[model samples]
Target: MPKVTEAYRRKKQLEIAHAAKKVFETKGYTDTSMNDIMLEANIARGTLYSYFDSIEQVFLEVLAIVDNHSFTFIEEVCNMKFVDQLNTLIYKEVVDLLRQPSLVQARAEYFFSLEDTTFFEQRHKRVIEGITNFLQQGVESGEFAPQKDVRSIAHFMLSFVDGLMLNTSQLGETSNFVYDQLEVFHSSLYYLLGVEN
Candidate 1:
């Protein structure tokens, strides 16, 4: 295939992924059929099959698209020379999650349903490891306050992120964090990390 034609193929695949995301979100993964995606993408059956042989293939790709840069974002930010800077990066990440709300929650829903499968289970484990490593380094460097079990704090931080994502997604409204609400979360986190108020 010509170079230009090959590029178009990649672009078309991404478009298909976006279409699949909408269908999967509206109709739940188990209820979504390949034909639903074909209709949503407005492509012929053969064309859809050319891109993805199975609905699961398309579902996985959609998951990939949604989570494309999140882990990389965390890893790159964690490499900052200062652990404090890394926390700043994490704070921004949490804020972005707050702003979009649904993006992360949708991903979580898809992930839990797929957990029994090796592919999903391995990816989840990898995420936990990546997060744990970052938190461990932060504690060692005094960026985060150490609990006897820093690992629990790390897990809770991730769970907090997940909980907030689910709430925001379920609300499906603008982030409602008021000035007082923001202050409470910030104050609690500061106390947890031993940062001066």
Candidate 2:
């Protein structure tokens, strides 16, 4: 038998995580099990256990994959103007939520099922920090002059977006509802950033 290389291990892990993502998206967090993941990945029980100890661990890996993709997207748009970058990010997020409502449901269910929300809280904090840094960059470059503290604005923006996503997921998009809300959000964002629209 050949020894598994580190690269091989990583590739297998990603394959498994992607498979688990599909299962979670379909069945949600509460209903998904390790057996489901194993079947989805088409791996033996022992093979799956060797890579992941629990369903939560597999879910975390899936989240990591998503975060990596998001970071890569952010890096790709780093050179764009701050306003354009913001618009692109918002558009991508909205489209993703609308297109993958099951993913949104899974994520919400996973977080709600957690007994200790420290992980979710930490992730949320990091997101707010990232947004704050982006807002600060805009200010430093003379593109924005926020009416409030950058961090506060970042937190508020994140909260508002979260609420919008949840509402859109539950209520379903009807009669251009999402676009109308997004238009309002964009207008409010510009006002908060003290930028002319």
Candidate 3:
């Protein structure tokens, strides 16, 4: 038998997670099962378990993919001009959420519908910390004046995003609505940060 390298293993795991994302998006969390993911991934139960112990674990990995991408973009933007960084943050965080495909929204809604929020709560906390760091950097660089606590501002921004997600998920694929919401969020953030036009 050929030996599997760590890179190969990680690639296979990501493939499984991608398949599970499709299943969860289509069938939803409550309706999706290990069997569904197995069928989607074309893997045996043992093979699936070798990668993920449970469907929730797979879902968490899927969420991590999206969050990681966003965070990476935010990190890049942190090095840009302050106004550009601020605009990109709204674009990535707010507009992107609104523009996500309906199936992706369905997957997000599944997690929101769940009573246990520990998974999402932790993710939200991490996001807040990252946003706080970015805002602090802006304040230190004279892009933003020292005003309210950066942590508090981060929390508020996160709350706005959470509300936008809930609202957009319900609206489905309405581009106009998404743009309108994006404008509102952009304006709100610019004003909150006291950025000059």
Candidate 4:
């Protein structure tokens, strides 16, 4: 048998992950099975099992890929003006949620289905930390004058955005509800940051 190089293994794993992502997006976490992923990847059951022990493991890989992509945006926008960075981040998030409603559904379903929320909690902690650091930079630069602790503000901001996405996913976008709420959210942020709109 030919030795499987590490690079080849990694490439195959990513291919399976990408295929599983599509299955999750279409069927959500609860409905997706190993067979679904196998069919999506066009691989035999043994091949799928070689890379992942279970569906949850594959989903975790997909989430890791997503988290990496998200942080890449943060790095890319690090040099932008403080307000511009925040605006761009929030706009991109909202736009992505709108464009991939199924992705939102899949994520929500997966997290909700988990008996232990440690993974979700840890992920949120990292996101809040990133946001806090970004906000702290604005504070240090005299661009933002947050009335409350930056960490607290960051937590609230994350919660608000998560809630907004959940609601939009469940209730459906109607009468420009997302834009209306987004406008309100932006106004609230300006007030909280003591920045002129």
Candidate 5:
């Protein structure tokens, strides 16, 4: 009985957090209030408090949700044929931005208001490490071109996706051109990698 009660409470808490996320996205951080979140969640003020200590904490949870989803997609791509895996990873990252990806906006607001975080270091290391290991395998198998500087290429490849997102932000809807650009980037990577044409 107690176990069921706790499970129900947790489910209710996630629902409240999801509602607050929608409100925060539309309202903007400075413009949003705890009352607004409570109203959005359709929960009593005390019920809201039972889930989150503060509005900022709720915002962090939303960003964490976006980060986690993106990483899960990334993990799924990591095991494919080298070229397919790389292309999928790059294409998915761009598609995220093209869809007005949540993490990009959340990150901007966070940096404008908050302190540096260990989350940044750990998440970045995990992403780069996975890509590096896959590329290293391709080189060993003679399936991809051997680069004298595997680490450098890994860094640049990661930067390329980030750079595309940054550029997409500046260009807005006009950035639809990035889909074509990404294809060219992938094709060049394949050719340079000495993968079968």
Candidate 6:
């Protein structure tokens, strides 16, 4: 048998994960099954299991991809002005959620119904830490007021984005009115951060 290189393994795993994401998004976490993913991936059952032990693991991989993508997007915007970072984050989130409501709904289902809360907690913690670090840097640089509680602000921002995404998922395709509301809501957050809008 040919030796499977590490890069090849990772590529196969990502391919399976991408297919699993489509299945989960269409059928949701509860309704999705390993067989469904196998079919979606066009891989045999053994091949699928060789990559992921179970459907939940595949779902987690998909979540990780989404998280990594979001974090990278935020990180890239870190060099921008503080207000620009906040606005860009908010706008990107709304636009992404609107473009991929299925993924957002799958994430909501995972958060609300998954048996293991550890994953959810850890993901949120990392997001909070990232936001806190960014805000702290901004404070040190005099881009933001020093009086704000970085941790609290991070928590609130996460909650705000989650709530907005959850609502947008439930409402299906977002309307202009919803976008308007998000603008107003983001303005309030900007005010809370002492960013002159």
Q: Write the per-residue lDDT of candidate 1 for residues 110-153, one digit (tens) a residue.
A: 66777477887776666677667876776677767753455665
Where does candidate 5 stray beyond 4 Å? Answer: 1-10, 77-79, 133-142, 146-151, 191-197
Candidate 6: which pairs clash?
none
- Worst-scoring 10-residue span by lDDT in model 5: 101-110
RMSD of 6: 2.0
Clashes of each: 0, 0, 0, 0, 0, 0
Poorest 10 consecutive residues by lDDT, candidate 6: 169-178
Tens digit per residue, CA lDDT, model 2, 106-153: 789989988999999998887887789889999999999999899998
Candidates 5 and 6 compared: the better one by lDDT is 6
The candidates, ranked best first by lDDT, are 4, 2, 6, 3, 5, 1
Clashes of 3: 0
Residues 1-197, model 6: lDDT tens digits: 99999999999999999999898888888889999999999999999999999877899899888778877887787779877787777777657666673676677677789787897888889989988888788778777774468898888877877776667667754543567867777877776677665
Clashing pairs in 1: none
**Structure candidate 4, residue pairs in collision:** none
Candidate 5, residue 166: CA error in Å?
Answer: 3.6
Q: TM-score ranking from best to worst?
A: 2, 4, 6, 3, 5, 1
Candidate 5 collision pairs: none
Q: Candidate 1: misplaced stretches above 4 Å?
A: 1-12, 25-31, 39-42, 75-91, 101-120, 140-142, 172-197
Provide the overall lDDT of each model, using Cα atoms, as 2-decimal numbers. Answer: 0.69, 0.85, 0.77, 0.86, 0.70, 0.80
Model 3 spans > 4 angstroms off? 1-3, 102-117, 173-176
Output the lDDT of residue 14, model 6.
96
Model 2 worst lDDT window (10 residues): 93-102
lDDT of 5 by residue, 1-197 (tens): 34558888778877877887787667667777889989988889898888789877887777666667666775676567766766676677657655663444545565566566676667667668866777788888677884346666667677877667656765764544887878787876676566766
Q: Residue 2 CA error for candidate 1 (Å)?
A: 7.5
Could you tell me the lDDT of residue 185 within candidate 6? Answer: 76
